[model samples]
Target: MIDLHTHVVPPRTPFLERLAGSDPRWARLEPAGETGDVIVAGSNFRTVRRVAWDLVERRERLAADGVTGHLLSAMPELFAPWAPAGDALDYARAFNGWLAAEVTGHDGFFTGLGVVPVQDPVAAAALLGEIAGQGLLGVEIPSAPPGAPLHDPVWADFLGEAERLGLLLFVHAVGGALAATFPHPGAANGVVFPSSIGQAVGGLIAAGTLERFPRLRLLASHGGGSLLTSLPRLDFMRATTPALQELMPQPPAVYAQRLWFDPLLFDATLLMALVDVVGADRVVLGTDYPFMGADPVTHLDDPAVPAALAAAIRVTNPQRLLTSLTAPT
Candidate 1:
């Protein structure tokens, strides 16, 4: 299984200092040691856990879990709106450069998803261009709303540019004000609800962004925040609303086909249900690795998942999503 949702951080002190200074809330945030790294607080949310995992440790963890490769992403707090945009972009550039350096010679063992400063889409676009030649499989953005919604007109050009560049967009639902309503709200409870992110993705689809940029590959973390169950209602609403009907293509399934979902549901039934709804091709393996409630091995061991589906979720689907990083035929 190729775990597509692991996270990494740069060890540079200046970067950490910048992060600490960029957001005022960092002063009140506490740190916890996990996997030999620390995660600090950011903004009003406390559920965002940050850890700096070394490449060696990450590879070892993958090997132990029978995971072939682990795609590196940013922690949720890394893209907070409260952070300085320019500083965030610089940190992203430096971090992506470091990540690319660490992963390039490892073959399929390690691949990275570049982080972008979505708060500043233009800068984000520039950073995307800089990392285009790097062995980055995709780009990670925090889920919309608390940061930037996918349907926000402000991000249209950025999304369009990403589409033109043939890069996949991976949205990990992060810090938000609505996380308190979740079943198990934590210190960073504001960003814990995957359902809210799913609703945001649904809204983006309803707004015609997917239709507008058909070539753009999108991956929503945490089983697309319950996408399997949400699609039916989304389709029903679209059909009943003339404006939505005109904006979206026939049936919502078309949009589903264009998007990909990661396997982080933690339940065999939910994961399999996603497969039944979106098919095997759109489901990719993701273990919110090194984080609480995320286990790499268990996700791959579900009996309800067929071997082929599991393999696709673990490897093939991610390869398709991060097309640029795959070796040539």
Candidate 2:
């Protein structure tokens, strides 16, 4: 079985220091046995387990948990949306290279998804080819850049390029202005991140992104962050607002089904709600691995889900998602 929403990080390198120069925004980790504190710009960003970089520990966890493969996204703290294009692109290239090699070294135990500097759409567009060249399936973007909506016109070229490449987009909530508004970790992570992802996913549907780029594929983290409860209001607004309807002629939920989601909701009821909206065909098993344990429901055999549905989420869906190591043809 495959876990689609796992993460890994590259240890700091001197080149990254050279890229940053005097900038204090780059990420650094302080190891603590099986755990570590991720510090960015001199402040503690988040505490993470060693699975963030240790493939050995990860392999053990995967074996113990019965997962066969993992999709390795650069840990969310490594997504530096606020950095300047030159620094950001360079940093992203370095990180992407390390991540791709890590996946290769794991002997088929992991698949890779890299990151791009989204603040500059043009540069981010250029990086997609390099990321594709490294044999990663796709890229992981923050729900949005610091202050801009992802579906804004500035990202059109980038989105078009990604569609042409058939790259999968893993939309995790990490960037938004709310991080500055809520300085405390609990406020920033618990509520703001979820809110950010929900807004970005909804914004993409309402913006007719699918209409413009039909082959674009997306997988959202945290069960797409309250998307379970948000679509009705979105459809209500679309029906009532002529401007929205002009942009998107279909109900928001109809477009939502075309995208993918991870069942990281931590509750069977919530997972079922997401499955009902997007369908089990669109739902994949996601552990948030090494961060939220290997399996949300413990194991597929536990009966939280039916045996048939569990096999589909654990195996069938992930195979379809990773059918092409290159982009989808």
The candidate that wins on TM-score is: 2
Q: Show model 1 residue runs off by greater than 4 Å.
A: 13-52, 145-148, 180-192, 293-302, 323-329
Cα lDDT of model 1 by residue, 1-329, tens digit: 66777776555422567565665543233335442233445344333334345567557766886777777877665565666777767777777887788887677687778877777877787777777778676798877633567787777887887887777788887646555456665544334556666876887787888888888878888888756677899889988898888888667877887788877776788887777777879888776766656353475577777888777777787776666445462
Clashes of each: 4, 0
- Each candidate's TM vs. the true structure? 0.84, 0.90
List model 2 lDDT by residue over 133-234, tens digit each. 899889999887755678888888888988888889899987456677876766677787677788889888878876777778888987788676889998
Model number with the top lDDT:
2
lDDT of 2 at 136: 88
Clash pairs, model 2 backbone: none
